[model samples]
Target: MAPPGCPAVAPVGKWKVIGHLQLLCLLALAQPGGPAWPCPALCQCFGNMTVFCSEEGLRNIPEEIPPSTTQLFFVETALASVPSRAFTNIAGSSHLTTLAFLGSSLEALGEAAFAGLPALRVLEISTSQLTALPGEALHGLTNLSTLSVKFSPIETLETGLFNSTPRLETLHLQGNEMESLPSDIFHPLRSLKTLTLSQNHLAELPGEVLAPLGSLQVLKLSDNNLTCLPPGFFLPLVQLQELFLDGNALMELPPGAFSRLTSLKGLHLQHNALRGLLPSVFAAQTNLTSLYLDNNRLTELPERLFHGTPSLSVLSVANNQLQALPARLFRKSPCLTLIVLSHNRLSRLPAGVFQGLPALTKLLLSHNNLTALPRDAFANLTSLEVLDLAHNQLATLPEGIFDSNIILFNVALKSNPWACDCHLAHMADWLQHTDALLNLQTLCRSPAYLKGLSLPTVKKEQLVCLPGPGSSRCRAEGLEPSGEPGTLPQCTYQDPVGAIHLACDPDACQQLSLHLPGQHFSENWTLGSGCGTVRVHITVHIEQDKAQPGGEAVLP
Candidate 1:
């Protein structure tokens, strides 16, 4: 029996002791220099191969790692620099394939630091203080495929950095301070498929900088300081599918800038200083599926600007200074599903602006200067689901604009000065009956009685029209003496429709021509008498209820 509160010492049989001895002998043979350090004291070793060390305040690489280790992750440490041949012991077996350092204070990488990593495929150093990559620092990484160094303050990349990494496929160098690259810097990476250089200080790219990147499928250069792109800049990127160039200072694109990107599907050019684009700039990119050109200074678009993009599904030109859109702007894109044209100065749109968009689902036209909509403005949008018209200068919309043919499910109408009068009665009725979610906080701006009142709270019956024809104001003119004095025929008659009323006695019968109110006609009836008490039958002819009395018949 063992002492209290202490580990018990079990009695070992001969077979158990023999098995323990065999295990110790196997571990000794694996090290060949007696028992090596089992694992790093500050790290947690999993399965005798993966080392996970994070936030342990480690200043340098841990020593005496097992020869069978394959992966290492050192995260959020205080290491300032990586020494040369940090993994030299493991280089013999060449088992390490991934080495990552995330959110650490590493400022510099020594020369030939990764000299022994022959089997490394992934090397990620993100959110660190790495300022420069000295030449020969990655000397012996022949099998490297993915190299990601993001959010590091790297100002310059050593020339010929990728000369040894010919097989590199994906390289992510975002959030750096690189302004200009060597003209032939990327000439060696012929097999690269994806590259991201966003949030950099690149103002211009060399004309032939991308001439050798024929296999690049994705390129992200957003949030850069690029002002303009030279001609033939993208002449060799034939296989590029996604391209991001937003947040730049591009004023205009030269013609044929994108003529070679035949396989591009998504393009982002938003948040730039672009004022216009050449009419044939995108004439060659026929396989494009999505386009974003918002937040620019463009005022008009060419009629055939999108003629080549017949397969385009989503297009956004919102937050621009556009005053009008071409009537056939989207006539070629029949598969368009989403369109965002908000925040512009568009006062009106052509009746056939949306002529060919048969698959449109979401349409955003909010924050414009539109006061009225065309009767058939949205007639072709049969598949529209979300229609946003909020924050516009619209007072009333045409009743037939959103007809029963539209299958809308969401309608945003807040912040519009809606005139709650007879003109808006149709809209009110539709809002109350339709299943669409009408976000109507639109208040009335006309009709002094309904000012400052919400459209929803106001009843439809309260909307009044002009006074009826019965309450029209009539006028009698051209009254003079028509017959003998004191013996004139009396004219006393009332229009059956109450459009006009006329009454006169003897000696008061002048040439009476009464003008009917609200009708463009005059009743001219002359009373004539030769004897006393002359009773005449008056025959009236109503020409669409608007003709005047031309002649009169007198009977004695």
Candidate 2:
């Protein structure tokens, strides 16, 4: 591992983290211009501590290593074996803390190959042809803290190979062909904190394999062929905070499987065959923050699954078969920020479903079957910034649905089958009010005449009418209200069913008048969807206008 405060380099594949001091050593390998020394002819020395060699045909270990060298790396070398006492000449004086054999063809190791390097803290052998190591391969390295033997074909490990290094902490055994592990292989390293065994062929693990790693904090077991986890498999990982179980064949997680891992903060179970999750599976994980269960076969999640995990912030359950969610499912998780429920079969959202998530910033419900949203759907989401309702069956939004979202700036309402009618006047009014709204235009997909027209350019009058009666034959032609300043066209629309919807230009301020003979009725009025400047509406009943069947009830 790099020193305590080394600037971090972005990790590539399984490249070990190295400091700038070590990076200079690598740069010397390609440039061959570091300070001169009595170094091996093919090796380049950096300062007084690091030596790097990358000659392809070199057959033996360079015997002239500087005694001040504390770090050595052999890249793409032909060195085949490290005989006993191979580095004894300089080990005592060098006090090597890091050694690596990358892209090497090494196949065997002498029992005491690392004898005199007692201060070694990091050792690695990756992209090599090494097949196996004897039980005593690491015979005397007691202070080593990091070890890696990745991308090698070694199928098995001697259970006693790590007996000499009890203080080891980080172990990486990924990219191997090992189908199974010896139950006692990791029985000695009690101080291990991070273990990576991904991209291997492990189908199952021994029940007692991880019983000794009680201090492990991160366990990565992704990209394995695990079909099922043996019961009590994670009981000993009480201190584990991040666990990656994605890219496996597991179908179900037996209840209480993670009951002991109360410290878990991030759980990745995506790309699995999980059909469902039990409500109490995470009852003890109150500290959990990010949960990923996307790309699974989950048909539904238990309503109270997240009730115990109030600390959750990021949740992605997309690419599942879920059709709906409980109304108060997230009542307890008030800290959620981003929720992705896209690519599901959800047809509707329960009112107040997201009313408790006041801190939510982005919510994506794209690619679903949602037809409409309730008016107060986002009542408590005053902090919401990004909302995606694209690729659904949404015709329009309910009136004042976005009134509470004052800070919302990014919204996606495209790709929906938008019916351009009076019901959609509210959407146009919202667009007019929020002029800064991105994705300004969407295609109207209904009413053959308005089909292919963009919503932003279409006049409000062209985008109106209730479902039946004279709603479609809109006539914005009649007498203006008395004392009105402008010669505004009277926008009249009739709805026999309880309400009449209308839209007009705010500048003209249209005055609506209706003439009904021998009939009068009570009135109920609300805000109109016109320019939003004028208030209109008072129900006028019509008994039977034998001359006009479209219900022109009251006299102007």
The lDDT leader among the candidates is 2
**Would you estimate the TM-scores of all the predictions?**
0.77, 0.78
Lowest lDDT 10-residue stretch of candidate 2: 1-10
lDDT for each residue of candidate 2 in 1-556, tens digit (9 for 90 to 100): 2222212222328777885346656564454344556777677677656777788877787766766777788888899998886777753235788889988899998987887788889999998887786788888889999999999987878879999999999999988888889998889989999999998889999989999999999999999999898889999999999999999988999878899988988899999899989899889988787889989998888889998887787889999999998998899888787799999999988989997786788899999999988998889798898898889999878877888899886778889988877688787767665443454557888754467677777666456444344532223333233335554333333334323433333234332333333244335333332222233445443334344543432222
| C-alpha lDDT of residue 183 in model 2 | 92
Best-matching candidate per TM-score: 2
lDDT of 2: 0.76
For all candidates in order, the CA lDDT equals: 0.74, 0.76
Candidate 1 is scored at a TM of: 0.77
Q: What is the C-alpha RMSD of each candidate to the true structure, in Å?
A: 18.8, 10.3
